[model samples]
Target: MSRFTTQLAAGLLLAPALLAASAVQAHETGDIIVRAGVVAVDPQENSGNVYVGGANTGLEVGVDSNTQLGITGTFMLTDHLGVGVLGATPFKHDIQLKGVGRFASIKHLPPTVTLQYYPMDKSSVLQPFVGAGLNYTTFFSEDLSSAAEGLGFSDLSLDDSWGYALEAGLDYKLTEQVYLNATVWYADIETTATFRTASVPSKVDVEINPMIYMASVGYKF
Candidate 1:
């Protein structure tokens, strides 16, 4: 056979393989779907700040109880496997050290993407999922004693932190567009903040309870 004919025949033999692979990928994609859910967060960080105040300054501040509206997108990779993206607004709050004329809050946005596996069908009324992932916490917009009158402005000590994530959740499908979900996840979000006006910088070895009671209504095609 001529060289051109030989190449043409080889391509013909390979065409079926390529077509099969494409079909497999397409099936995987169709089996896979994206699910978005609402995430509400409440976090408590420990710290103390100091400002020059004589006698006493109610430098009293409270724990940062922040409830945020966040979203999570999920994709099913297989009948028993899935992957997802969990994103949320940056969390912010202030701390008031009693008797000290100083207060501050650490702020950050935590965006996490995880690979999950489920043992139930999408059409199943109840589906549960477990996953592992990486968590990136970016701290920003840190401010001090904004509510504390006469409290001079000082710098905040927060740095970007990275950690591992372990998650487990259950999805109860009420309907295709409405489902109830509950998830509990743990992350090692240990970060250090150096208060410029305090005795020293504080290192926070805090575990963000990404663990939340989740309930959401999702859509499927």
Candidate 2:
């Protein structure tokens, strides 16, 4: 929680100055620059913890992976380092079970604040970076089966979730402000919800350690 406050402050102070930089066009740019990138994240493949209105070990829910559409921006605050923010559409991933078939999409919103270190010059062709950050994931629009009638599902709710991020990526510079960047991050987001489909309402906790891979084109100003 304390970390969230620090991130908030940094974001508040940084955005206005960065946005203003685009207008002046003549100022000596800070190594602390801001960059926007189009990010495409790999599909998420997950298996663990299933919830019904009640606790039943026999039932399980499997989630299918989906391609993620998103954008990530970084504000370089120093010669070799930066802070970043990530925004994306509510991630829609499918839930599948071998016998019960596939179910609805579960949506998630992940926002990250990272400290980045770039290892090479922009003209060097191949530049790599590493970062450590915090990821906050929130769940919404949960659904249940029609056959799951008369279950305590109405009492179910999803609590907000979050994780720690360790990231690494490579950048292929094509031009001054145009480049290709590929990144992979490991996240430990603890997500859980109530299952009302069972006779008694039971809580199902899922620990998802997701390995996210993203590739994108970017512009720096």
Candidate 3:
């Protein structure tokens, strides 16, 4: 299993014991929570056939996953509702062509804003929340592989994307001001990659729907 999965399983196994220990106030109106941790973006990608000079090339594109540092902050509008924003360091992904090896690398940032609902009482130590939001992904520093350069590929770029985001998370209070947190998000991301091959302009539409996971330590203020 993945590291995130293993950690999540361990956390769940420990939840019962933790929950039985004591009741603590987790969220309150006017509170702010900040969390920091590792985050992974795993893409479920699909792409249209690469088009060279407006003609189909019969080859599809793919994108590999990445991990990076993540940070999030939430402002409690009420004990049961909050607005949260997610940020991360730039994530780098390898781009591949079907039946071919990796040909490029690209970096992107996904910034998300969500409205979250915490259903449990404010006194509950174990806080579980659900959220819905919007994500904006901007791609930059797209570099072609050496092999791709030799094959006449140049000027790689991917268009920016805007899409919906969904989230679920759990937090276990470790102290009055600190907690252990785990969160997962699903984002709908699409982009068009444009470049040139053998002096011919080329483009391919790509869907990079990704599941994002994070395990964090949070502090309330």
Best by lDDT: 3
What TM-score would every model get versus the actual structure? 0.66, 0.72, 0.89
Estimate, for each residue in 92-131, the C-alpha lDDT of model 2 and write its tens digit: 6655543666544567777777887876653355768899
Q: What is the C-alpha lDDT of each candidate?
A: 0.59, 0.63, 0.95
lDDT of candidate 1 over 112-213, digit per residue (tens): 878888766444567788999998888887666664324433556667778887788876655544556677666656565544333332332234444443
Model 1 has an lDDT value of 0.59
Worst 10 residues of 3 by lDDT: 17-26
Query: By how many angstroms RMSD does model 3 differ from the true structure?
Result: 12.0
Off by over 4 Å in 1: 1-38, 44-63, 98-102, 121-123, 146-153, 198-210
Give residue 60's error in model 1 in angstroms.
13
The candidate that achieves the highest TM-score relative to the unseen native structure: 3
Candidates 2 and 3 compared: the better one by lDDT is 3
Q: Each candidate: RMSD to true structure?
A: 11.4, 14.7, 12.0
Of candidates 2 and 1, the better by lDDT: 2
Please report, as a residue range, the 10-residue window in candidate 1 with the lowest summed lDDT.
49-58
Cα lDDT of model 2 overall?
0.63
